[model samples]
Target: MVDANVMKKTFTVPEIKPLDQYDFNRAKVCASVRWLLAKSYGSAENVPADLREPVLIGQELQAGVSVLLLSPDLYWRAHSQLHLRGVSQGPGQGPGGVSKGPGQGPGGVSQGVVQGGDHVALLQLLASRGHAPRDQDRPVTVEDLQHTPIKTRAHLALIDALMSLAAMETVGRVKMAAEAEQIGGGSPWENALLFWVNRLNQRLRESTEDDDDKTQTCTDLQPAQPAIRYRKDKVQSKLTPTFPLVSGVKDLSNGCAIAAVLHYYCPSRLPLEDVCLKDTMSVADSLYNLQLIRTFCCGTLQGCCPLAVEDLLYAPPTLHMPLGC
Candidate 1:
């Protein structure tokens, strides 16, 4: 069974002062992006020392590898929200019509392997930042995160890792196909990449199935509830399924987080699968624009250096929000 208290506590919009709370606003995030791009182009420490040798010597090489690296962090933030905030009701509800489980259960681990890596990385980074509790720092609080900057190099490193992983998979898969003339010469890198890609795809598909089963169980077992808040405004007004404890902040973030998991696990490869980038972009935009989500992003940025919520929000081909702003 899901913990109602945890959901009630985490799902609500964390109270925060407006611009004062977040160190890096929209502009600072943008600048950090340029810095990342410069590092990537210059080959000036963009790729982690630990990962560089493997990446350079890999079987399938990608022209722009940073994209893969970024994915893990993005998915981590998204998955963390999903993990923390279980769906209350409506479209994202679980099987027994009860709240979704917190840890690994029917609806858990839906995020992909790469995303899992990001979750681990995020915790390590947070621990280094002091946001993560130590033996001395027993309790965790928003105040602990208040002064920290959202932007950090670690986030950029994470993005690069995700982009690299995806690229490695794509290139590996591409190399596996034998042309009429080159049928005899097998590419080793291609085979290796295919091995992992196939595994990832299968795992993600199964996770989706698990989610479906949970959803079915919830709907079948529980009776539907009444709407809590209704208003004329399209944006502010509540639609249905008024669970008293769960706040709007928690509800929306949970939806966005689930959507993020779906996105990371099921990214549509260009010239391969037609995963709608536009749709994903729209979701990212809407989530960042929300005051609550922006605050959460800012919170995640706490103690991190050189990376900010703005960087994620304004990435080109994503939002295309102006850099100077």
Candidate 2:
């Protein structure tokens, strides 16, 4: 069933008239290339070396915001904290590793690379525990996850994924707490909301750190009541207006990708934005399998536009509408 809120947005008629820009030639170019690359290989890292400039140009045209297309697997790692939950290796199983089911070889152990099956098993296990399985077609259980054996590299990758997720959450909460009242009901969309909050808060902090008065104001704004008063007493409460958690997903998704934007801030800096998961398709697609419920954030459109709910997976690469529109 479609989310009712998501449904309503599809019919929304925008109130504000469109305004002209200085020529988003740069932004358009970047967005187009980013979209093409993401769609072609289901990852931006696969973007050809030659077209990178045009893509950056497109991003400039679209405003400073660049529509980043990520490999579904990398998308999960960055935006969804699903990888944090370690792969279950069965009941009473030790950390060293032992095969619990089929495919066991000599010494009743599994060896070699950790395949996508192992990841899916972990997802299934989590879903059963949470009772939030996305797929009705493939029924799986925690028992299955407990039996999958993953290689050391996959294990380490999972750990790194978890750390990244935690960092995003820790930072996001810091930002959210500052404007808790402004955030409406419901848990922040379980995927990317927290990540955005973290990035915006980081930017706000970095921007104001050098200014003593600004620093004091930000610190003073920490407590809710004091923050309210500070808002009245201080002239600039809107510097980075607390991002209102609306009944949509664009803000959260954009926030998660801010790190990517930061990568492009200066030419001298290395671009880590194009980094891809070692195994992109198989690993990422497995998340959608009944065993794993990991949600990837890409092409997630959200904003004041009419088709805000039209997610990246569903729409075309380039559009005249706003990035999240």
Best by TM-score: 2
Model 2: how far is 287 from its true place, Å? 30
The TM-score between candidate 2 and the true structure equals: 0.28
Best by lDDT: 1
Per-residue CA lDDT of model 2 for 89-198, tens digit only, reads 46433221223345643212334212133445334433444432222344433332232331222222232233333333443444455454344543333233434444
Q: What lDDT does the true structure give each of the candidates?
A: 0.31, 0.30
Q: Write the per-residue lDDT of candidate 1 for residues 1-325, one digit (tens) a residue.
A: 1112222343342333344443333333333343343333222243344433322332222223334333443334332332222223343333212223344323222332221243444445444433343223243322322213322334433333323333333443444333312322323323333333344444545654454445443455664332222222212221122111111122222223322323344343111011111113243333333333334323443312232343333333222111111
TM-score of each model, paired residue for residue: 0.21, 0.28
Query: What are the runs in model 2 whose C-alpha is more than 4 Å off?
Result: 1-123, 129-131, 135-182, 186-199, 202-206, 209-248, 252-325
RMSD of 1: 21.8
Model 1 residue runs over 4 Å out of place are 1-30, 33-208, 214-285, 288-297, 301-314, 317-325
